[model samples]
Target: MAETGEGSRPGYSSAVELRGVGHGKREHAAASPPPPATDAAVLHSSVLDTIGEEITGDALPEGHVLTLEQIRERFGVSRTVARETMRILESMGLVRSRRRVGITVQPRASWNVYDPRVIWWRLSGPGRNAQLRSLTELRIAVEPLAAGAAARSASAAERERAVGIAATLRALGEAGDLDRFLEADIAFHTLLLQASGNEMFGALADVVAVVLQGRTQLGLMPHHPEPAALDLHEAVADAVAGGRPRDAETGMRELLAEVRHAMLPLWEPRTRKG
Candidate 1:
């Protein structure tokens, strides 16, 4: 589901595992006392993301790499903060570091391109054209199959929820309420994935959320869902409700293709041109 990297780096995966566990605890502890609200941790992540945006915009190409010292100076954050930020970037496949090599910008193809966080970082500017393109590629691969599974497996209630989400998205799209549209989009996708009855599939909900956020920020997709797009989403839900797996798969494929087409115009020549 979530690809981290080569597994060569010590403690590379610990942070992600910790984050996932924290997320699960948050989800399950609905009635439990809240944890220390570390707004700064989130802010740290945001600042690191901004650093990524800068890298994407200017420093990454022609091998103008960065060091922890430089990063600390550039961001004016503590060495620990800068280190953690680079760890975040490394996890997203934006940077690679070794015991001695320090850090280097990995090529676009090397990125964990499907991670929503990475996608958001890319959508922050011109540097992420490759990242956006890779994200679409992952969508093309995973979504149609997920749709088919949903078609074959979704319960009646799940199907209804999917359809309702799509419909609401359509209305929001028509109103140009991009924020609401993205929310509905996430709900629609989460319903479909959850309907698959695969826990791993369900885990992608966060990734989907990130992708929607990134696309919205990039101004590629509408703030609101397009009516036609909404209709296609509905068609998929209907197929899933009817247990027509092939139909659902085809419907989802078409819908994703349409979105990709819409996004192609927004992508820069480096990413969009064949």
Candidate 2:
């Protein structure tokens, strides 16, 4: 596991200091009501996100002990907030709390890697390259199969939507609209999985979205997506729309292979370092 960086607990500035007000004004403000109930939820989420990132980034390695008291003290949060954070993390398989032994950070193997939130945290951390590589491999394995299935079995409306998304992807990629391109790219891939009519494959939509966004965020995407890649995407959409299973599979495989090759240089060094 690679340590990304130090994780600091969230904090709030004193309202008086934040406002840079006179003593009388400070006293008045202090007498006012505190923030709304939603602020507490925000605080809980902030603590949960910070601790989750630390664990996934290896800042808090497996077997490290934690406790509600420790979380409350470190983050200046209430015991309720800390307990809720722990409960969320436990549900995500990032930690395990025992009555007497305290909370221990779980091994990475225990994590719900397929969870979109987990994938997002990993992508935002130092281990992003590894996560991207893993996702790419997963996409390579399943996407072509999904494309083939979609071509054979998808409803007409699904096929039409897939084609429309691919067209949008091509337009966005060509215009160097990275944000929209990534969005369209995710939509195209996710639609393929869902249109395949396989429940298991459909559930991977979030996984594909994370991978697509991660690559763009990490600056792994080219300034302009290669013409060949764009062409393959169009080909895949056409084939699926035309109910050509073989062509859909072949085109999707080629597109994925090209993406993998393009990303190899970015991922190889990280692999060696790990």
Candidate 3:
């Protein structure tokens, strides 16, 4: 199993299983608030929301660069907090500060689309059709290939497990049990990646988990998948288990195309706010 990188999505190399979409763990422990860090910092959600709205909400106003002092005063935080907040913003690719100039907003293109934090932030808005499309696109690009490779490489036991998981997912869907269905879905995909016998590809289990997490967060999976969707995974697993790489690839591709179509209805209304 690959050791997850510092910012890697969570569950990258573990088989313990994840409940929802996306990898990466967040610390949200509830503790009594301590004295403010002397350095300018704003730790409240209100401040983070304000900053996100400022950058992504509108076109930059004339000479819209924000000085550290300005952020501190605007949010009523110590300079240290403001500075730390700026660092956070920079990590999100929301702003850039040069030696001479203060923090200047970066174009949306600079944002880390793959970073779980940014994706979560974006999903907090009114709609998440774009995010959904992007995630599924990521799945389409990587999963089919993984399925083909799994067909060629999986150990006998791993192949059997993959087939079993696929059957379980189908049964869960048939029972209209979304919660268990999602669990089986995660396991089904994770098995495919693990069975591929390529560490780089196997590492993508986190990515798959993340995608499922995002969808579940947005209420997209429905109470049960369409029956056709339910059958898709089984077909892929069956092809792979039978050592039919080409068939596995074809089945996976078809499954992805169906997912893409299911997602189109959600992305139809544009949400690009300038």
Candidate 4:
């Protein structure tokens, strides 16, 4: 989200305003109808991003109240923009509203943890290391199983696509093309999940994409992916293409184990001295 003007509400300085519980009310003429479509789209995206960051960052902790009036006044946005922002957050399981209780941030357990945006926000905040560990553990559990399923069920085209993307990922990684490597890596894993022929596994593509991108963006990835890691990815693709379920599963386990090992230091607790 682009950085923009400061909030209009007193004691709130963020581009998107978030008022505390005890802030006093200000009576003003109702906000003008929202701006043009392009401007409105920008407003919506900005507000949604800011509010989402707050919730996932725990700045607006669970049970914090976010009233419609507070949103409108603090952000200097029309009621429509404010309501739409709230709707987006609600759909993502971040906040909920009631007649008298207002809009309250929901607990983390209630969130749509698999949603890419939610994953990004969480990774951007204080919980990043923990989130990374959790996501990697999840990938370790599921991706190997998905690889085996893909070996049995994937169509010819799906297998071909997976192999092709894996090749591209290996090339990009070896060349130290971080951005393109991240893209191909996402495509490779996503294809594996979709080819598994299990709806639940297919739906996890976004979650995997988020983790891959998050690792690179946060500078956690090595300058070039390890050669063995690239080789394991190719092995997974070849195994799935050849309908070798056991080999596919084994290749994925080894790849994820390498990843987990690389990430372990980040996940360890740090000590401070006086």
RMSD of each: 8.1, 11.3, 8.1, 12.0
Q: Rank by lDDT, descending? A: 2, 4, 3, 1
lDDT of 1 by residue, 39-157 (tens): 35655655665666656555465245778988888767788988888888888777887776678887767777555455544555554556566667677777788888988778777
Task: Provide the lowest-lDDT 10-residue window in model 1.
Answer: 1-10
Candidate 2 vs 4: which has more lDDT: 2
lDDT at residue 203 of model 1 (Cα atoms):
60
Local lDDT at 173 for model 4:
88
Candidate 2 residues lying further than 4 Å off, grouped into runs, are 1-40, 270-274
Q: lDDT score of model 3?
A: 0.67
What would the TM-scores of all predictions be? 0.66, 0.80, 0.71, 0.77
- lDDT per residue (tens digit) for residues 131-156 in model 3: 66766788889889989999999888
- Model 4 Cα lDDT, one tens digit per residue, 173-203: 8899987777677767877887899989877
Model 1 score (lDDT): 0.65
Candidate 2 lDDT score at position 161: 78
Candidates ranked, most accurate by TM-score first: 2, 4, 3, 1
The model with the greater lDDT, 2 or 3, is: 2
